[model samples]
Target: MVVGSDGYPLPMARFFPNLAIALSRETFARIDAAETVTNLLSA
Candidate 1:
């Protein structure tokens, strides 16, 4: 389901933890090891 799916990992979050969130927005989610917005969920 990723455009550039080969650009990141997949263990960063519980894939589709909620159908509402997964399909609500444009679903701009991805896993980058550069430490980007990884902590946004906790904040």
Candidate 2:
């Protein structure tokens, strides 16, 4: 998950309880994979 300038994630965990907790490795891996794909596409 990304932590914004306020030391919180962009989605704002306080409002979205679903993403508040520490994400599992599998979830993080998925996000990383997506980011990589996005970056490749952008490049």
Candidate 3:
């Protein structure tokens, strides 16, 4: 449901920032250990 400035659909990778935060939280949601993780967004 996301689009670019040109009105074209944006790829999933374009959501890296949101994805990274959601993923990291979900990854440790049920675990006791939490660690900082970095996500690199590249074309």
Candidate 4:
């Protein structure tokens, strides 16, 4: 979760839904790619 200057969670979904969605998608994509690579190398 993104933190605000006030030390609270940023209302990203409410104020910047597009950005929030994009960030989540990118994060998941990276994680999935990393996992795939790790599995391939382990095998």
**Winning candidate number (TM-score):** 4
Question: How much is the lDDT of residue 39 in candidate 3?
Answer: 25
Pairs in steric clash, model 1 = none
TM-score (C-alpha, index-matched) for candidate 3: 0.35
Error of 1 at 24 (Å): 0.9
**1-43: candidate 3 lDDT, tens digit per residue:** 7898899998766777888888888877735333222222321
lDDT comparison, 2 vs 4, better candidate: 4
Candidate 2 Cα misplacement greater than 4 A, ranges? 1-23
Which of the predicted structures, 1 or 2, would earn the higher lDDT when compared with the native? 2
Q: Which ten-residue region of model 2 has the weakest summed lDDT? A: 13-22
Candidate 4, pairs of clashing residues: none
Candidate 2, 1-27: lDDT as tens digits: 768778866756656665545466668
- lDDT tens digits, residues 1-43, model 4? 8898799897657678899889899999999999999999999
RMSD of every candidate to native, in Å, equals 15.2, 12.2, 13.0, 6.9
Which candidate leads in lDDT?
A: 4
Off by over 4 Å in 1: 1-17, 27-43
Q: List TM-scores for all candidates, in order.
A: 0.18, 0.47, 0.35, 0.62
Candidate 4, superposed: residue stretches over 4 Å from native: 1-15
